[model samples]
Target chain A: MTAPQDNPQPKLGIIAGGGALPARLASAAQTAGRAVFVIKLDGHADDPALDEYPNVSTRLGAAAKILDAMRANECRDVVLAGKVARPSFSAIRPDWRAAKLFMKVGMKALGDDGLLRLVGEELEREGFRLVGAHDILTDLAVSEGVLGAIAPDDQAISDARRGLSVARILGQADVGQGCVVQQGLVLALEAIEGTDEMVRRSAKYRREGVGGVLVKASKPQQDKRLDLPAIGLTTIEEAHLAGLRGIALLAGGTMIIDRAAVIARADALGIFVLGLGDEDGETNHGV
Target chain B: MTAPQDNPQPKLGIIAGGGALPARLASAAQTAGRAVFVIKLDGHADDPALDEYPNVSTRLGAAAKILDAMRANECRDVVLAGKVARPSFSAIRPDWRAAKLFMKVGMKALGDDGLLRLVGEELEREGFRLVGAHDILTDLAVSEGVLGAIAPDDQAISDARRGLSVARILGQADVGQGCVVQQGLVLALEAIEGTDEMVRRSAKYRREGVGGVLVKASKPQQDKRLDLPAIGLTTIEEAHLAGLRGIALLAGGTMIIDRAAVIARADALGIFVLGLGDEDGETNHGV
Candidate 1:
């Protein structure tokens, strides 16, 4: 856990999945004067820009190759990034290394968070340091305050608070990351369906007056390095189309991809983008 | 509260909204030699069969007219039935009597169960006894057993148990009546969008395996006299389309409309229809 400044920083091993965040993280690491090596997930990490880094395309089940590649490149600090839907057990032809890991974790590996935690433990046991995506890309972490010009109205705030409580419960069960609430009623709850589809499904249930609010937060017992809640331009566009009033994210625990563009879109659409402070103490924003 | 056989039963007052339940109840009462008067909510109760009985079509907000019509028809026992989407306050133009009732209930009338309880109290104050739809249509109340030729496999039973726990938590908050779960993972939860949409939404999240299960239960502290959870042919068809294995309802608390036809359709589709017993001791049959 020593800071990079305290010793010669090891090459960052970026195990990339799908989405822009991986590429962004690689660029950030390189800009910080740390060499980067990426093991792009074969079918998932489709970003062409990832080719610029000293990288190798590998299957998620090819754990032996992934670990060897990281070792060969002297990459001790690894950061797993982007979206990867859990591959069905039938679909994954795990190598001996992955099969051994699966056998160790057993049925507990089926859950999203549980699998990630086990995988993190495996990586740590193999002598690799796991860094959170937020740690390297600090600017992407949402801060407390309304990001855009518009702030949530009283009704939207109430809806967001309700959504937060629901989302927290769902997360505690390792179910979902977000929910939509409107006019003191829960319009929809996200489960296996991703946030985009959940927002779209909620449009049909929209009541009159101030529209619903989409709220996302980290699981109370979440491992920050695995999957911190995230939002981007697509989320903003979808929220607008769904007739939602705004979006709320857990401050310091949620990642905002392309914050500038997202804020611009939110401002143009008159959608409030709020960053809720920690749940325990009530200091920062009005949220 | 006296049994109909114990005394000369008063004329039944039917506060009909929308759907077949109202008409079915009217015919059942007529067969039992009880006079019935239907106060159909205008714009909602479109059933033409109601015209065969002593009835009046009145606006929901016209409380004076509705009560007067029932009293003039010598109706004392009342049954509220069928689907009625809560009309927004702006959409409902309440008469003075209705307005006074709303004032008395105040903001508590905003929720579905709360509003029903308040209205039921007002009706009782007017000297009318509120009877449950299930009490009159005893055959419709689900019994603890598996209906249809098909029975749920181990996987679907596990999914139903998972859905039941989630649904109960949601019900405690007065949030929803049902949820869909697959392979121990919650797929979708019903809220304001209703069970039909929740099933349709869950279809996209279907995993490769023995499909999901839809579980419905009355709220743990639900007023059964108001809205008891009910399923019909549409539920069967929707579950089939959603790639779901079966449907489970809380035995005794849930109503099955057109039970014979529902069972026949379920058998034809090879979908299991299960009646879950009270959540206490071991059930009569495997859940």
Candidate 2:
């Protein structure tokens, strides 16, 4: 093995899942003058943008192949990016490594966060340094304050605060990451249905007068390296279609995918995007 | 105010909401030779069966009218039956009684159970004893063990156990009443969108192999007198369409609206209807 001093900045290996975030992270690493390798998850990492990167496609359960691909490319720093859905217990045909990991966690890994933690641990134990996508794309993390031209009114802000607490409780239970609150009533919650579907369902339960606010946050015991809550232009479109007035994301904890485009769409649609203060820091009522 | 020695049982007052339970309760009370008065929730209690009952239709916020009618008809016992969606803060134009109750509970009443408790307290304070629908329709209360011809297999029973805990946590938070679990993965949770919608949403996320199980239970701190989780033909139809294998409801804590019809339909559709044992009593894992 080469001395640790031989390569202070090792090649980054990105295990790409579904969405544009993985492609963006790969680009960011290249822009930083560092070589990168991409392990595209079969049936999930279908984004054409990933084609430009040096990558190999493999099934999610093929852990041995994934580890070998990263090692062959001389990648030591690994980043798991995008959305990797929690595989149903019977659906996953785990490799030896994956089977071993599952044996350790068993049914506890059935939860989304639990499964991610197991995957993160496996990667670390294989001598690969786990890196969060946000580490490479700093600008993508939501900042504390309002985005776009629209600022939430008192009513919207109040709804957002209620939604924040509800979202946190959901996360704490490891049940969901977001919820839509309208006029102090929770309209819809994100379970396995996901955020976009939850947003769509919220439209059916909206109250009179004002629309709801979409609140997104990381779970209290979240492993940030895996599945940081994210929003993009599609989120803006869905929220608009669902008649939501604004979006509230936990500042520094949520990822704003294509921030400029998302903000521009929100501005055009007259919907506010407010970054709630860190849960560990001062309470951000958007005051 | 007649003396207690004058008459033993006063007329039963049912503040009817949506669904068949109100009408069923009305019939059950009449069959028992007890006089019944129904206060039909206008725009909500639209069941044609309710037309035969001695009733008055009033807006949800018109608590004074509802109470006055109940008093005029000498309804000393009240049962808040059927589904009442928590009204948006601005949507409710509360009368003196409702306004006072809201002022007392503040936004605490925003939750389903909280709102029911407030309504129950107001009824008690006004000298009417609150009754549960299950108390009126004794046969409707689900009993332990398999209800229909088809019994849940071990896999289905395991899914139900996982779902029961998830549903309990959701209830403890006053967020929902049910959840769908498939192959050890939570597919959907019922929030303001209600149980049928949650069941419908679960279909979209079903994994391969065995279908999911729908588990319905009263919230951990559920005010059983108000909204004990109820299911009927509609629930059966929805679950069947969603490709669910069976349903497990909290025994004695959930009301099976038209028990015979629900069972017949479940048997006809080849789906098992299992009643989990009472939460406070024996652990009924369907072993």
Candidate 3:
């Protein structure tokens, strides 16, 4: 491995999961004048924009190959972005190296948090320091305070605070990152079906008043560099579909995949965005 | 509120949900010399052996009348037990009193957790002191240690530890209590579908020597005086259906309704029962 020259813009290696975040992160990294390396995940990470990266790559579920490529290409920092669903557990065909590692663990190790911890641990063993997605892409780190045009009323704000607390608690449990709460009630909590599905469950609850709050946060012990909670246009679209009025997030911690685009979508949907701060903030209480 | 007199054998009011717990608790309390005023939750509470508690009286969903009977009978300690589900959000006719209270909150505030919290808060406001179902029936709490004739194999133990950690984290988040882990992979997390359904999902990924660990815990912030995480014959039956080997529960903290009967069933099914300490325990290295 070469002792690479220090480039002002560090290249970002995106170990992508399915959905729009990988493409969004890639674009964001490019805008920051850094080379983007896309080691797209199997079945989940065949993004069309991979070709646009300075060094696009592919590997079919082999941890060794994944580490090799990152090290060989001098990619010092990496982020695990987007969804890697639990149902994919049965579908995964681990390669020789992946199988050896797999044999060391059991089915319970396949949950997002377990697998993520294992992945991050495996990387650290190879001498790579994992960094938060926001460390490399600051613009994507969701800003504190509102982003969209609509200012939620006091009732909506209260609901958002409540929802945010429940949602953050869910993340800490490693159960999920999103929950829809309105007027001190929880309409839905994201589980295996994920955020979009949880939001949809709220529709059947007969929304009244300012609707529910959609809160997302990083899991208490998550490997931040690999996965930061992200929201893009689709999230806003789904929130609107679920009859939600506001979104609250852990400020400066979670990532907004495409800030301008997500803000624009939120604006179009007339949703409020609040960067929930840890201190002096209207706290969302957990269970 | 009148200063309650010290009555060692005070009559107890039990809001019986579905399961054998109420019936068992009734017997235990009788043995302890206390009369049981039971409000059997329709469709959920078990059909007890009527011969067992001939004089034990019950009510349907009329919370007001039940409270009246308890007060008249001097039953100062009210214990909510069993698993009558939170009234359905879509099609519940909350009797006049529940309706009047429910009217103050929007539909978004009626998820199970929200509704339970509201009910407990309301009950506290109305002068009833909520104690645990096992308050006078501590004999019914699962023994703190490895139970059953069989112990979980090494792999199962690892998953159980992971399941315990995740379950507690979820508890802290105020999410549901149950989780399934197999071979270190998280197979299913209990959500709105609840515990039995989660076990069924884990069954899908079942393999020999891949026995999953199922853990159910009370959320860290939960008020244990009410809404304790409870299990019964149904849980043991579900473990068999899901091919689980180890069942981890928070030692001393969680309540097992009908503890003796539940253990009998679990023993028959060869499921390992573990009352885990507050901290997650280590696993055997290998089978």
Quality of candidate 1 docking, DockQ = 0.32
| Fnat for each predicted structure, in order | 0.34, 0.47, 0.44
What DockQ does every candidate get?
Answer: 0.32, 0.37, 0.25
Measured over the true interface residues after superposition, the C-alpha RMSD of each candidate is 7.9, 7.7, 6.4
Q: Which stretches of candidate 1 lie over 4 Å from their true place?
A: A1-6, A100-108, A111-114, A125-127, A277-287, B1-6, B100-108, B111-114, B121-127, B278-287
Determine the iRMS, in angstroms, of model 3: 6.4
Docking class of 2: acceptable
Better by lDDT, candidate 2 or 1: 2
TM-score of chain B of each: 0.92, 0.93, 0.82
Native-vs-model 3 lDDT? 0.68
For residues B129-240, could you state the per-residue lDDT of candidate 1 as single tens digits?
9999887888889988787789988777766766776676567656678888776667787877778988998887777755889999888777788868889999999999
TM-score of each: 0.88, 0.90, 0.75
Output the TM-score of candidate 3. Answer: 0.75
Best by DockQ: 2
Which numbered prediction scores highest in lDDT against the true structure? 2
Between candidates 2 and 3, which one is better according to TM-score? Answer: 2
Best-to-worst TM-score order: 2, 1, 3
Prediction RMSDs, each to the true structure: 4.8, 4.6, 6.5
